[model samples]
Target: MEMNGSQRIEASREQVYAALNDVEVLRQCIPGCDSIEKTSDTEMNAKVTLRVGPVKASFTGKVTLSDLDPPNGYTISGEGSGGMAGFAKGGARVVLVPDGEATMLNYAVSAEIGGKIAQLGSRLIDGTAKKLAGDFFSKFSQIVGPQPAGDDAPAAEVAEKKGWVGRLRDSL
Candidate 1:
């Protein structure tokens, strides 16, 4: 399956790029992520639990980033196995562009799955993937966005202005 989209992050391009590469930040942003360990400047291992429809499984995977261009994004690819559930491998090319006070993160992704997960059907898998992606970006933006100086009210206002979900829906 192939999925592509972009998110408007409420931060500078450099800030967005840095957060994307930060293992701790990614671990928090990714839904059901158990852990993320950096093995090298451009490589990491991850453990994640995901549910696609009625099937839930744990995945252990390795991700590598290539085509380095600091503060401009890079290519990411990874593969994982979920025991009896299935296996999945995918790659994404990400690009970051400055947008005034914010950054626009664009990504194009393609993936393939096999075993029981594949039997669940493409529609289900596709929807689940999109949902996961949306969740990641939404959480990421909230973490990376500028915090209000002193109030919870302004935080909600910031979230509204960020419009992460609205942007994702528009892209899809």
Candidate 2:
């Protein structure tokens, strides 16, 4: 399946980018995400529980970020196993564009599933993916608040200077 969309995030592009890379932020935003542990600068291990149609499964996965371009965006990819339920692999290209003091966040995602999950039919799988993506973005937008003029700081500064540690702190 493939899906794409854009959202107007009420935060600076830098701030949005920081949030996107923060494991804690992503853990909070992703639907049914139980945990996200950073394993490297560009990779993290994740556990998520998802329900599609009448089936529910817990998946363990590794998520990786590539093609980094600072506050602009990056490519995110991951694959997960659900044992007998199935397995899923997907990737997304995310781009962040500055819009005044806000940011325009766009994403294109491509995914595939096999085993029992694939047998559930495209309509069901597509609907579930869309719902999950929507849920993530809505939660993401809420956490990445618009910085007030007087108390604003670009998160990209932290990412560039102190790496993920500083970015994580700023994200929180």
Best by TM-score: 1
Q: What is candidate 1's local distance difference test score?
A: 0.93
Model 2, position 88, has a per-residue lDDT of 97
lDDT (0 to 1) per candidate = 0.93, 0.91
Residue 126: error of model 2 in Å?
0.5
Per-residue lDDT tens digits for candidate 2, residues 10-82, read 9999999999989889998999999999999999999999999988999999999999999899999999998
Worst 10 residues of 1 by lDDT: 147-156
- Which of the numbered candidates is closest to the native, going by highest lDDT? 1
TM-scores, each model vs. reference = 0.87, 0.84
Query: Which ten contiguous residues of candidate 2 have the minimum total lDDT?
Result: 147-156
RMSD of candidate 1 to the truth, in angstroms, is 6.7
The list of candidate 1 runs beyond 4 A from truth reads: 153-172
Clashes of 2: 0
